[model samples]
Target: MEKDKKIKLGISIGDLNGIGSEIIIKTFEDNRMLEFCTPVIFASIKTMSFFKKHFKSAINFHGINHTDQIIHGKVNVLNVWKENVSINFGDEDVKIGSYSVKSLEAATKALKEDAIDVLVTAPIHKHNIQSDSFKFPGHTNYLAEKLGGKSLMFMVTPTLKVGLLTDHVPVKDVPNYITSELIHEKIDTVYNSLIKDFRINKPRIAVLGINPHAGDNGVIGEEDDKVLRPTLEQIKSKGKMVYGPYSADSFFGSANYKNFDAIIASYHDQGLIPFKTIAFGHGVNYTAGLNKVRTSPDHGTAFEIAGKGEADYGSFKEAVFMALQIFKNREEYEEYSKNPLKKAPKKS
Candidate 1:
């Protein structure tokens, strides 16, 4: 790979009924973005046209059947569907749901085929997009199965990084999923992501407890004391810097996460509630531990603001930049891995 070459960023046009196309159009309309990488949007001309007209967007698109036709300076649209689809602005429809899957299907296939370097997925309607094809909870699980890696639903920002042990499961089922082995696997994934993905040297990880006040040391729950305590002790003995079982209420109130490199939450809302509350429109949901780099905006499809042009593009735009940066960071990490020992600094 050449250092000066631009990375090819692939984008899946999630749920057309929502704001996916609008944000994609608005993000590319900013000419300054072309300087970073060429973007290939996997959607049909009809969908892009619907958004461009509805949003009064000014971005120009170069449509082609294959990725080889990608134009560096224009928004490139890879036509996945041939028929002209109707643009149902704000409601969920069966036909639109199918197209969302098709776009993601085509994008992931291209990613595996090496047509694109990184992927930035737009938000999708999880319930509507469910089919025999996409049976997983969200992008993290689907990509984990598709790309062959243990996926971590990592929510990231400039200062904070959080990974989930249970993604998209019911609150009642979270405790059932929080076991010793699950703790080790997910926390190890988070620890590895901190070093390889974020370039953190000797990263420190914090673990969030499941029950209230981390089970109040068995007064409220037994799993935190029996399972988490022993597992964390074993992990600590393995020469890793990890701590916690911290109470969720006080953890965020004082911003205690600032002291660690990463935090492992027992479940989705445990970590994401605070993360979204703090960085709602600015955070990035990174699918770490996959062979390919994939990210999405922290927020979901804004059906209320579908065509209002009121949806903020900050999170999606940040997802794009974060993908490119991670691609570069992986390169540096690989080179560093080859030679971990830094030679003594040359005498000035």
Candidate 2:
């Protein structure tokens, strides 16, 4: 945790059949990536060799039996699997799914052991990987559970940031999950994450209404006025700058998003639809309120474009850069808190 030490980043090679391997290979093509952190990929040497030939990437690989053997310039890969098997590119196989889960397990173990500073996960297909052994909804839930289940999903870009009140839930079931307690917990987590992780002091937060027109003043629905409004009042009493119950329809439009540091939405599509529209192929999905730093590209597994060299690496690059920036911010904030006299001027 020293300020001058390079962060030890552990990466999980998500769903080898998808574009995860391609993007991970493409991301390391930039030699400058080595300067930020020591990247260790939890995957098989055979699988990486297959990708190096298939994608025609210039990435060199180094086989290491342990994380202590990680080297820069060449991708330091831990041989998670002992057996060699044929890997059919772009084909869904349960064995590959099992292997993906194993890779993630190794990465999470390293994180828990304090062997790595941050985790950068690639995309994985939930449907293909949800067997009896690996039965989590996605990486967010799986990682949260491994880290004692105290985290929230927040999607971030340079222009906008959003935290989901309920993720991976059915639309009909979202309202039931949005209790007064849940709202308060999510708001508190987002506020603390902004200040501690992103170094934003006194962040202005906007909360989106569950119903249209903010329940049309209770004519359309009562959840916004009854559940959200009272919660905002409680948060305001604590001296936090939180506004809203704004109608979801006009909140993202009308350029209202620029006025706030973060937005809280009731469900998945309600927030992600607008965010993806604006920050498509550029957003990074961040898991805040966790003991460790974790981030992934906003996009999912691109099945159709897998292994064709057609998938874009923009979001993957953004996720890596965001992790580095947040790590730096956390370091500086810790230093400033300990020595207020050396505090730098706040950025405009």
Candidate 3:
């Protein structure tokens, strides 16, 4: 990745039967998007051609068979599969889900091999994308295993950022997952991401409680008082600006979230529900604390409006822009760390 080179943006076309194709087509249809990064879609041009025609888009793709063939200033489609496949909009098919997995695998491989600078994945269905090979609940977990990091499901926007302590866990099992060690790990991940990825020098973080009223001093629940409080206290003792155990019920409605750079929710819905409500079509689901940068629209496979051409592409476009910015921020952070400025000599 040369500094002068445009970032090789790798795209994983999500569930073909869903609205993934429509959003991707709409986002890149605007030729102005090519100015930021050279996008390489990890699906066949034949498949994409069908989408383009269906959407009535006037966009053309620079079809390539290999990553090396990718050209700058063009929407490049790398043929991950050659066969023309059937498409049924607004339907759930295991075969179609397998193609989503295929595209993701190819793009992920390219990312790991440094053939692509960053990855911006479209939405994928959680159910049909399950098999012996790909059994993860979502992209965050799968990427954490493949890319090797303490991946955090972070939903982000310019004015608000929210990170989940636990994602895709059953409500009954969330408290069991929240422990002293897990709290420390997620807090460290979010803190470091603020500095290195989002370029926040001194990040202020807040955590939401797992119980109603944050346990109300053990009346409602003891986990928040016994677990969350102690863990946050331990973290604050380390001189980190971490504060929390706030009642999740009133934290966001009271506008307390604006006081911190990031908020760590106790679970998935606690964080994502508010995040989507606030930034719905404009938020980016950034997978923080990973060795490589990855982001996706704050959405999922829109089965109801799959091929109606009514899907919104704003979030998808923002995901691309967010990934590019994070890549540059990480690059700059690395350069600064490698060659830090010499400190001024102490006065006599």
Candidate 4:
């Protein structure tokens, strides 16, 4: 494929009982998405038929037998499985969970083989999907393991981009996982991703403190002062524009976040709470530092409103848009990095 050409995207239909299929149908309603890339959904034709009948969507569905049959401006589904699963709205089924994982595995295989330029995943049910066969925590860890374990989950919005040092872990065990080496690795990953993947020339990053009031100079806790500060200093000395140990409570409200390109949060909630508050229906949960571009909707499987045709598709749309943008950005960066001073015209 040409570097500047429209990239092919592989879409994985998540939990069938949830709002995954519904949102995927709703998002393709916009014909303009076809102008950017060709989307190939790794799902069953029966599942798409079920959603079309249930939701009364007007999308034109095409059952693709081969990858060459993928067409833009249409929903192209590669039926990987012959699942005769009947879905109940808001109901949990192990069969649906297994199907979701199967679709993910297919999409991941395409990504690894370079068949797809990017991967846009729908929301999956973590609790329902948990099994002995799939012992990973969630999509982040699962993708990490599949992609050789070099991945970090970061929730991105226009206002605030928050990267979690540790994701999907208990709050009590968070402190135990906090180490200078871990912080260094996560921040390094985020910083390099900003420049390489996102195409930011000079990335400025802000790291949040672990404890309340930023440890109040070691009064409440010493982790911020003892661990994070020294790491920040070492990173700063290495010529990366990073500043941190900021109090999580006040940092969200302050305009200082806009000064930096990305925020490295201590844990999951500390980063997501403010990110969702500002960009609830617009946030894109991107798994950065991976070899390939991967993005998902920040929201989860809204099983309560699954088949009612009432689930909001805003986040899912943003996730798709983000994948397209990042794919293009990475391509541009790679081209420019290879040949500096090329002076390409700006894209509209």
Candidate 5:
């Protein structure tokens, strides 16, 4: 796995019309970022140049047509193609969608072929990016299918870690999807991710209730008691430190999250609202349970701020660092898991 060498971070250049190139350029402008890993952005050099005209940065890059040409300590861009379409920022054009898919497909192919060590994806406009080849809600679903594993949309920050039981679904449909089996699968993914990716020894997790006020003891809803609580009980009895069915509203207000390694939210907003509120500029959306490491900035494609030189690169930079760290941690964890110490002979 090239454990001794510096990591090669494969990046997908989200939507060409968005602020992806801006943030990516800003993140790698300082030479300090290169010391940890080599950044190979999967995009066209022309799109990068367009963004460079808007943002004033000293970020220089090396253009290559193939992944094998990647060089350490440089912003190596593997241009997917010499894009023929005219550049137009902030518009959701089909041309942009096709090119974005090319970037994603190429980057993912590199990841699967072991050409790149980790992947830090940029944001995409959901409506425009949909096509015959891509039919999932977002990156998490697409990655899960390609990478082969149960996907868990985990939002991570320094203080809090939140995983979703159900992701990228409608608010009304959330209840029907949250079954005991789904809870077990998501929580198990979180527990293992904490141990291997984040390097936590024992990951104690909390689950937020599905109903308001935790069903108010069934006065508000029935899922909290009938489904969630019983499932958690079984999980705890089976040797995992899992707990909850706690009221979601008050859970984050009191900062009770500090007491646990991670929290499992019933749906998207129930977890993301508080997380983005606290760590919007730096939060990382990590797709756990995938065979390979993948992470993204918490925010979406900033169409309004495109080419304005005002895009914040904090979250994107954090995503890169997070992916690198996870790659290292997983390597160490796998080696540790593979071999155990032998018992010494008893003294007479």
Candidate 6:
């Protein structure tokens, strides 16, 4: 955590059957990435070598059996499993899914134990990763339980940010899930994250309507007038800069989102659809409100282009940079805020 020390970045190799391995090696292939953070990949060195040869990458790695042996300025592959598992590039094997879970479990443990300062996860296929031990919808929900905070699925870029009220929830169930408490909790999470994570002093947040035109004043539905409007009013009464139940259909088309620090959507697709459309391949899916820093590329595993070596590493690379920046931002926020007169560290 020292200012001069590089952030220890932990990586969980997502579904090997997908583009996870390909993008990971591709991102670290440029040795210059090591100058920002010490990368520790939570998969076997042999597995990484197989990927390196398949992708024809010239990236070298520092192999280690444990995290304690991690070396800075090297792509360290900590041996999570020793057996050589067969890989089918585009096939969805449940066994391959288990390996992704193993990698995530080990990397999360390291994060909690302070072995790593931040984590950038590759994309995981949601269906393949379901098991008795790991029965959450996705990483955000699972990490929420593990890290003990009201985790928010915040999809962000430098210019735009969108948070979800209900992620990975079915559309029919989204309405029932939106309650007064959920609004307050989600807005509070976004407000705090903008300040501590992004250095925004006073964040102005806008909420999207749950129903069309926010229920058209009861013509379309009653939830907007009865549920969303009242809840936001209560938040505003508390002296927080919260606005809307704006029509979801026109909010982005009119570029209204640019007016606020962040937007809270009523459901998953309502938010992610616009976010990815605007910032695909450049956005980072950041999990705000968690005690630990976690981020992933905006896109998912591209099964169609799994082994083609045609996958883009821009988002994955951005995820790494965003995690490191947020980690430092949180450190600096704490350092200066905790002590009124703490001297700023000198730049190198």
Ranking by lDDT: 3, 6, 5, 2, 1, 4
What is candidate 4's lDDT per residue for 1-348, written digit by digit as tens?
474566788999989899998889898867777777778899888878878888887787888866667776667898888758778878888878888898999999989988778999998888777888997778889888888756899899765789998899999999899898898889988988777766676889999999998899999998989998998999999999999889999898976788889999999999999888888999999998788889999898888888888989999889988898887777777787788889642422
lDDT of 3 by residue, 157-181 (tens): 9889999999999999999999999
Each candidate: what lDDT? 0.86, 0.87, 0.92, 0.85, 0.87, 0.92
lDDT of 5 by residue, 216-273 (tens): 8999989889999999999999999998888999898898988998999999999999
Q: Which residues of candidate 2, in runs, are more than 4 Å off? A: 1-4, 344-348
Worst 10 residues of 2 by lDDT: 339-348
Native-to-model Cα distance after best TM-score fit, residue 300 in candidate 4, in Å? 0.4
| Residue clash pairs of candidate 3 | none
Candidate 2 at residue 283, lDDT? 96
**Against the hidden reference, what TM-scores do the models get?**
0.96, 0.96, 0.97, 0.95, 0.95, 0.97
Candidate 5 yields a Cα-based lDDT of: 0.87
Predicted candidate 1 versus true structure: per-residue lDDT over 1-348, tens digit per residue? 586677899999998989888778878999889889989999987768777888887888888899888877777899999898887778988678888889998999999899999999998888888877568667787888888887899999979888888889999888888888888888888888777788776888988888899998799988889988789999999999989788887897798999988888888898999999988888999998898999999988889889888889999999999999888888777876778795422211
- Candidate 3 — which residues are off by over 4 angstroms? 1-3, 342-348
Instruction: State the displacement of the C-alpha of residue 100, model 5, in Å, after optimal TM-score superposition.
Output: 1.5
Model 5 / residue 1 / CA error / Å: 5.4
Q: 235, model 5: CA deviation in Å?
A: 0.4
- Predicted structure 4: lDDT: 0.85
Write one digit per residue (lDDT tens) for candidate 6, span 1-348: 666788899999999999989888989999999899999999998899999999999999899988899999999999999999898988888899999999999999999899998998998998899988889888999888888899999999888999999899889888899999999899999999998899887789999999989899999989999989999999999988999989999999999999998999999999999999999999999999999999999988898899899999999999999999899888888888889598643321
Model 3: lDDT of residue 157 = 93
For model 3, what is the alpha-carbon lDDT of residue 23?
87
